[model samples]
Target: MLILAPMEGLLDHGLRTALTRVDGVDRCVSEFIRITDQLLPLRSFTRIVPELLRGSRTPSGVPVRPQLLGSDPACLADNAARLAELQPAGIDLNFGCPAKTVNRHRGGVVLMDEPELMQAIVAAVRRAVPAHIAVSAKMRLGIDDERRALECAQALEAGGASELAVHARTKAQGYRPPAYWESIATVRQGVRLPVIANGDIWTVEDALRCRAVTGCSALMLGRGLVRRPALARAIRWHDAGRPMADADVDPCVAALPWPQVLPLLAEFWQDVCGRVERRHRAGRLKQWLNHLRHAYPEAQQAFDALRASNEPEAIAAWLLQHQELAALAARAPEVEMTA
Candidate 1:
C-alpha cells in the first residue's frame, strides 16, 4: 500500500482532505499523539484524531491510522485499548520521530536505542488491542547507527508487531542528504515481517530506485507528496511503464481565486499556530509558502507581502491583488496588441 507519512503540524484534516482526493494514496496515518502519565480523556483523543469524531474518515473519507508516541508500556497499552473503541483501521506505534523534544523524553528514536524497552512497549500495546486490529510500527534505522536497526526490528517483530515501516536514516541523519535505502534492504533481510521503505522518495525516479534497492513491497511517502500532490500517481504510472505528464508542476494553485486560496492557506497556518505558538506561526507559514512556491511562483510574492502581517484579513487582501496580477499575466499573451 502507498501510505502518506504522518507529519505533525502539517497533516491535519484539511490537508489530508486535499491529498487523499488525488490518486495513488492507499491510506494515511495521523500525527503522533503524545501520551503522558495521565489516562487521556476520550475528548482529547477525539480532538487529536478528529476523524474518529467525523465518521472514521478524513473530511474526504480517507482511512487514517492513529499513531501513538510514548515511553510507558502500560500508558501506551491503556491508550491503545481506548483507541480500540474508535475502531481505527490499525494501531501504529511511533519510534521514528527524530525531533529533539521527543527523543529527549525517550519516546521516539531514543527508544530505538533500547531494544528491550521498545519490545516491552509494543508487546503491551499489542496484547491490549483486540486480535483483529492490526498493530504496526514506524522506526528509523537506529538512534545513531544502522548496526542496531536489525536488532530493534527483531525486538518489535518478536513483540508481535504485524509489520514494520523503516525510514532509511539514523536519528542523527534527520532529513539530511542521501537516505540509505540499502539499510531498509538489510532490515528486510533480518526480519520476517513485511517491510515498508520510507525516506527521501521525492520523485517517481526515487520511488523506482527505492523499490529496486530495497525490494520492499510497499512505500511510505512524507514530504514528497506534500510538495507535489501528484507524486504518488506519477510514480505508480511510471511503474506501470506509462508515465503521466508532470501536471503537478503546474498545480492550479495560481489559478484559484485569491478568496479561495488565501482562506485555505490561512486555515493551515491557524491550525498549526494553535498547536504550536504565535511566536512561531509566521516562520512556519513562510516555510509552507516556500514549498507552495515550487508549484506556484506567485506564492513567493504573496508570502513576502504577508510575512509581517499578523492579521489574516490584511494578508488575504494582498494575496488577492497578487492573484489578480498573475491572472492578468496569463491572459495578456492571448489578447491582440492594438496599433
Candidate 2:
C-alpha cells in the first residue's frame, strides 16, 4: 500500500486533491491537528481536513485518515472522539514529527522518549473512538537514537494501535539521507501489528529496496511524491511486472512526461488560487514548482521564469501560455523520416 504522508505545511487539501487524481495512491493522512488544553470546535477539524465534509475522501476518492498531535492523553482522546463524529476514514496519532517547535511543546517526536505516555495516548484515543474507527500511529526511531525503537513500537501496538508507520529516523537524524530501514525491520519483527516503512523512498528501486529491507509491504511517501507526482503509479507499475525501458534512461519518463505534468500543475494552481490568500498564492505555485524541478527540466525552467513574480495574475498568465504550448505540441503531427 502506498500512503501519502501528511506534510504539515506543504501538502494541504488542494495539493492532496491534485496528487491523488493520478493513479496508485491508496490513502492519505491529513496534516497533524495540534490539540492543546481545550476541546476544539468541530469547525476546527473540518477546517484542517475539509475531506471530513466529503466522507473523509479526496475529490478523487482516496480515503484520508485524520491525524492528531499532542502530548495530553485525555485531551487528545477528547478531540479524537469529537473527530470521530465526522466519520473520518481513520484516526492517526502523530509521534513522528521532527520539528523543534513541536518538540518544545512536548508533542511530536519527543513523545518517543516516553513510550509509556505514548501508549497511554494511543489507548485513550482507541477507547474514545468507536470500534469501527481504526486507530493508527506514526513514530520515528527515537528522540536521539534507536535504543527505544522496538519498545515504542510495542507500546503503540499494546496500546491498541491497529497499525504503525515508522519513519526510520530519529529526531536527531531529521530528514537526513540513509534512513535506517534495518532498524525498521527490527521494530516490525518486535510488533504484531502491520508496520509501514517510511522515509527516503525516492524511486521505484528505493521503494523495492525499502520493502525488501524492512520486510514491510506498505510505504508512506512525503517529499518523494511531492517531487514526482506519479511516483506511486510508477511503483505500482514496477510491482505489477510491467516493463519500463525508459526508466533508467530518464527518471522523468518513469513517472510523468513534462507535457503530461502540465495539467496537474494547472489543477494545483487553480486550487491554490481559491484556497490561499492573494499574497501567498504565487509562493504556493513556486513552492510546488521547486519540488517538481527534481524530476522535470521543464519545471526548472518554469521556476526560473516565475521566481521574480509574486503576482497571481502573472502566474496565471504563465500557466495559460505553457498550457497552450503543450496543447499545440500535442496537436502537431510527428514527421516520419524516409529511410
What local distance difference test score does each model get? 0.80, 0.92
Tell me the tens digit of each residue's lDDT in model 1 across 156-222. 9999999999999999899898999998999999989999999998777688889999999799998
TM-scores of the candidates are 0.84, 0.97
lDDT of 2: 0.92
Most accurate candidate by TM-score: 2
The parts of candidate 1 lying over 4 Å away from their true place are: 245-284, 318-339
The sequence of per-residue lDDT tens digits that candidate 2 reaches over residues 1-339 is: 999999998999999998898889999999999999999999999999999999999999999999999999999999999999999999999999999899999999999989999999999999999999999999999998999999999999999999999998899998889899999999999989999999999887899899999999999999999999889998988788878776454542565788888889999999888878999999999999999998788899999999999999998999999999998787666432322
Report the number of the highest-lDDT candidate.
2
Question: Least lDDT summed over 10 consecutive residues: which range in candidate 1?
Answer: 250-259
